[model samples]
Target chain A: MISPSIFVFAPLASAALFTALMVVRSRNVIHAGYWLLPCLLAVAGLFGSLEAHFFVVVQILIYAGAILILILFALMLTRDVMDPKQRQTTKFAPLAVPLCIFVGLGGALMMARAPWPAIQAAAPGPAEQTKALGLGLIGDYALPFEVASLILLAALIGAICLAKAEKEPAAPEPVIDLRGEIELEESVSAGAADGH
Target chain B: MTANLTHYLALSAALFGIGLYGVLARRNAIAVLMGIELMLNAANINFLAFWRFLAPNSVEPQVYVLVVLTVAAAEAAVGLAVVLNVYRSFGTVNLDEIARLKG
Candidate 1:
């Protein structure tokens, strides 16, 4: 029997793959950045199809919403947004293409050959799943959770420091011709005393 | 066809491949970062698929996914900042142009 989720999953998977291809192939960086939005949304949809309800929300909210925006901001801040004249890929792109294809095919083949011991148990109800997740985070995973927070804080400070405009060193104090000024003043005084 | 673990894994592999190509081939550093984000998403998909299929009752996979997401956010933030800084100093974000360390 075909699962109903296959219908949802198929379209989302296609969208994700297609958009990801567009992301890589687009000459315009901003267009590539925009392509990532749908790719991320499609991944979020894939999360929903997997019944990772909370993750669906998080994926959409964080990956699609926050990270994509950050990327777009970076794109805008950078000068060359649409440089069609410049080659988008490197000289080794031909080699990279074959290597990537080999990697994907090898991974798929390995996964197909592996005999996964998939369990038959169904996921808990959404409410229970969320509660368990919350408990797990605060209970057994407390240390990691705290560590993640610390990492975020550090990243925040680091990003600000890195992106901040470098202050131009104070202009070197103008070299004062103090000797010339002093000589002129002494001559004027000498002339005045001679006149006296 | 039924959507199974293998299917999701295959999709993730394909996505990872595309991301790898992006990272390896793109001349722009931001494009490379986008590729990294794609690869991370592929890993996240793998985590959720495994959680749903191999161990639905356990919260470990989900927790791990959350942690990965947190790290990805941090990475993107720091990475973009680095890219901006690179652009400011070098006046270009082209990976080839910023090859001062190519010794």
Candidate 2:
């Protein structure tokens, strides 16, 4: 039977599914970016259900607010945000059915007996949790954080290099014909040169 | 009236399944990124679910989820930055066509 929580999570789940499909199947990349908003918000609701109030707020702010907007900007930065032409990649038909069955069964059964653990050893309150996180980041996991930053730096440099590399090749933009529809394929990458 | 772990699990499962569909079916790189984000969010829900239903007191998962949040932010920033370059070079966002390094 459905509970009141169903009233909330149900719509959230449906929104997530709808937006996800839109994001995948949408012809326009920029349009897909806009559709991501609802999917991220649904995930935020899931976070709320998990009792991570902080995560819910943060997901909204960072994922839905910042990241989605960034993606939209990136899509817009390219010239072709609204080409109604449908492009073709390999038909994504055969794989969808088996994948759905596998993921559905795997996710459900895998989570069925998932050891939902809660530490009763020490009752760390929310305030203490923040304190612990700060300590862990600075004291123990500082290296990993720094490492991630370095990787990001590398990606930044790589993006820059890629943008600069092919100033010479000078090939016109590659246009893809999906189902006989021409779609312009340009990299929104800021760093196309270095990696190239 | 309170949602339980099963509720979170079902939600997460659905999310995961959707993500799998996206990763498999979508050809655009950015759309694939969206799929990955969905998958991560599903896992995050699982973390918070365990924390709530199983623990209900400690905030370690909460902290960890925040860390994951930061990581996801970093990833999107960097990944999109790279994708921009990928698009510029290849002129196509289809993952299959970007196989220049396939040598």
Candidate 3:
């Protein structure tokens, strides 16, 4: 009989692998970005199977939701994403097939030789896992958590500044136009009053 | 024929290998970033698998995964921002074409 885990994990894993391949292989940049969505969601599903409930939620919210959107925006801003002439793979791409086989099989063989412990599967109650992860974040990992938030804040500001810099020079043009319009309106009002 | 720790390990290894291939073979900056994201996911899978099979009761690995996710998000944001900057300076996002410093 096929195990339930197989039924769930197989599809998710295959979907992830397929989408990841599509993400790198698609000629259109926008299509590549779109392919990232399913890849991320499948990884999130894998996290759920591992009983990392908090991570599953976070993976979906942050990776699939936020990061993918950010990437899409970048693609739209940076490239003519619909252009079919864009090159998808480099000259070195053909090497990837053999390298992937060698590396993957070699790593798997090495791992198969390791003496992994026969510990119990993580069957932690989902609620308990979430609560424990929360407490640990606040209680034990608070310093790292704070540091991570600070880094994220810095990254956020840095990205904004980087993306905003180009628009800064052109910004004065709009302001100057607005001021001229205001002055023109005031002159029109004065003329109307005199006429009245 | 049940799925065990070794199976998860193999899967993670395969994913990591594929990610490495993507990283090395892709010319587009955004595609390279996608490759990096896949690599991070592979690492996260390893973390969770090890946590489940080797240290089933510990919450430490989960904490590490959380940190990884934060760093990954930050990396993505900064990476895409840089990609945008590059695109503005150069009319192309291809890494090979952006070699202005090649003295």
Candidate 4:
């Protein structure tokens, strides 16, 4: 399988570990979003090691390239991206500490009991992978696949409506309040002069 | 280095656990989405590993991973959209403030 040596795996593993931690701990939401890039790249490298070459490309293109960038852009669009009051990373450390240890034990248990796949007669070459997958999706899986796509489209339409609805309601209230405040201040001064 | 089932299983388990921690601990909706992605990825590793080792010569595992990848992409799209809605509704992406299940 022409795999790289342990040196490559170990560092990549450590980097992934560090980045995942940083992903949760970075208070600046944008910085935390950026951490996903290294974390994802390391995983994509792992996919390459596993001989899932196509997955590696999709991982880089879809996840690191697209999703993470969108997340950062969203963070920037929000006014309070990392305001001090909303400290994302300030004291979340203690709550999850023991939970992490328990999770490590559970992972160990899962490793011991993992079901290995039964033998296959022949491995599909990577070149044939896309073709085979496309055939499966449209063949036996077509009905379910199409239904799921319809559901997704419905959801997309719903989201657009909700985002649009919010903007129209918020615009008029501020202008109405500004005019009321100016009139109210003028009324209070005129009343004071009449009393004097 | 002979690749064995145990090595792959260990990798999958570790990655899944990291993902689990991320899901439970991360406050940012995007980070939680990333955690979910990691968990799906851990499953993919196991799928490909099984195809490589046990089913030494089958197209099924390759196809299985492809389906999984597609599903994960769809899931991420839906998940990100939901996170955006949540941000618009609450003005913050922190999940702790939005404990209610209903809209």
Show where candidate 1 strays beyond 4 Å: A1-4, A168-196
Q: Encode model 3's per-residue lDDT on B18-92: one tens digit a residue.
A: 788778887788878988898899999989988877776787988888888889999999999888888877877
Write model 2 residue lDDT over B7-90, tens digit each, in one string: 668767867777777677766777777777878887787787677666655546666676676667767777777778777766
Least accurate 10 contiguous residues by lDDT in model 3 chain A: A167-176
Question: Which lDDT tens digits does candidate 3 get at residues A70-101?
Answer: 88888878766336586667787788878987
Residue-wise C-alpha lDDT for candidate 4, range A1-196, written one tens digit per residue: 4333456566666676678767766666677778878988987886666566667888789778876775666567663644635645324546665676567557757766867544334445567765665676688767656765675676567545644535555445434577788788888988887889
Per-prediction TM-score: 0.87, 0.72, 0.85, 0.73
Candidate 4: tens digits of C-alpha lDDT, residues B1-103: 4445555566667777777777777777777777777777778878877766666445567666666666666666666667777777777777777677787
**What is the C-alpha DockQ of each candidate?**
0.65, 0.33, 0.64, 0.30
Please report, as a residue range, the 10-residue window in candidate 2 chain B with the lowest summed lDDT: B54-63
Better of 3 and 4 by lDDT: 3
Top model by TM-score, which number?
1
Model 4 quality (TM-score): 0.73
| DockQ winner, 2 or 3 | 3
**Model 3 spans with C-alpha error above 4 angstroms:** A1-4, A170-196
Please provide, for model 2 over A135-171, each residue's C-alpha lDDT reduced to its tens digit, 9 standing for 90 to 100: 7767767766577567667656654665465567677
lDDT of 4 at B49: 70
lDDT of 3 at A133: 79
